[model samples]
Target: MERSTEFLSDIDMVVGPRGHRRWPDAVKAQIVAETLVEGATVGAVARRYDMRANHLSEWRRMAREGKLVLPAVTEEPKFAALVVRDDVETTPDPEPRSPLDLIFGAVTVRLDAGTSAARIAEIARALNASS
Candidate 1:
């Protein structure tokens, strides 16, 4: 007597008899993108996607290490403070004026008691241009 053999399909291999929802690749990619590239807090993203923040963090770490590939996204630049000092020692005075002061000395514009709005506007524009 010959015996018949049966093989399990792809769906059966992924999902067993028990009903369980496995995380899809797209969802994992989204979590990584939002947490890493977008600079969103893992907790916030987790809450939005209804997943644990710890899990999302792990995925982010893995993606950073090249274990996974997340969608490309832009990130903001981080800045650091730098201090530079010169050999010249200059004391701070109550008033300090640069060379530009001599080029454009302070000019006072006096108007009579009855100065028209247009004339005042023109004077203001001229002053700005001089600067």
Candidate 2:
């Protein structure tokens, strides 16, 4: 391959006081909230806004701790109308779940179908204690 080096442009970002960026609280909150959308990732949001992933993660943590506040969505929630036709048959959304078998190091815990989280924790603790 022949070596060909071309000029690449750099993004011009305004450095705020003390050589650090001074993002407004609202902007930070918006960026953090974008990651909260279904199937959204911190890396994607960070890349879209051209900022560090760590910073966005930190902002999300701050929002969780009530340090930063995200603005409420202006649009009202809308739900798609469900349509039914006599010619069409409807199937159940999900089949009934079967019993669960959890296997750990030298231990196996079989749980009844639809076991609650609290019961699972209790079983785990009991198993750990017996060992």
Candidate 3:
């Protein structure tokens, strides 16, 4: 190989201060919420967001501690109509009936028979939103 001491002058320089980025609380909450989804892992979520897993874990801890509030991931109505069977007997029975059961995926909530429709709707919406 012949020794050629020619200088290559073509060079591109990127000049910017490298520092820690400040993420908005809303953005942080959104990212944390993604980790809460079923079958989502902290490492996977962090990688998807181009962040460190430990940092995401810290944010999750903050959420648990109530220091950070995650926005509800619901796009539907907050309350739903509670439906009752017209065939339900209005007269008092000799035996107390079982509590009203609200099933959401793997979770089941038992509400009293006298529970208000609004309250039942609120509980159902909450359960549906969580899932």
TM-score of each: 0.39, 0.47, 0.45
What's the residue-level lDDT of 57 in candidate 3?
99
Q: Which stretches of candidate 1 lie over 4 Å from their true place?
A: 1-19, 37-39, 74-131
Looking at candidate 2, what is the lDDT of residue 119?
Answer: 91
Pairs that clash in candidate 2: none
Best by lDDT: 3
lDDT, candidate 2, 1-131, per-residue tens = 54221211122334567857567787788778789886899999887776689989999999999999998976577799999779977787897788898777788778888999999888888877777
Better of 1 and 3 by TM-score: 3
Q: Poorest 10 consecutive residues of model 1 by lDDT? A: 4-13
Deviation in Å, model 3, residue 12 alpha carbon: 28
Please write out the lDDT profile of model 3 over residues 1-131, one tens digit for every residue.
55331221121222237834567777788889999887899999887666689999999999999999999887554677899899986876667766999988889898998899999999998988887
Candidate 3 structure, TM-score to reference: 0.45
Worst 10-residue stretch by lDDT in candidate 3? 5-14
Off by over 4 Å in 3: 1-16, 75-131
Query: Candidate 1 residues 1-131, lDDT tens each?
Result: 54222221322323446834365665577667877644578898777655578988888888888877887666568788887879879888655433221122567666664566787777777888978
Instruction: Count clashing pairs, candidate 1.
Output: 0
User: Which segments of candidate 2 are over 4 A away from where they belong?
Assistant: 1-14, 85-131
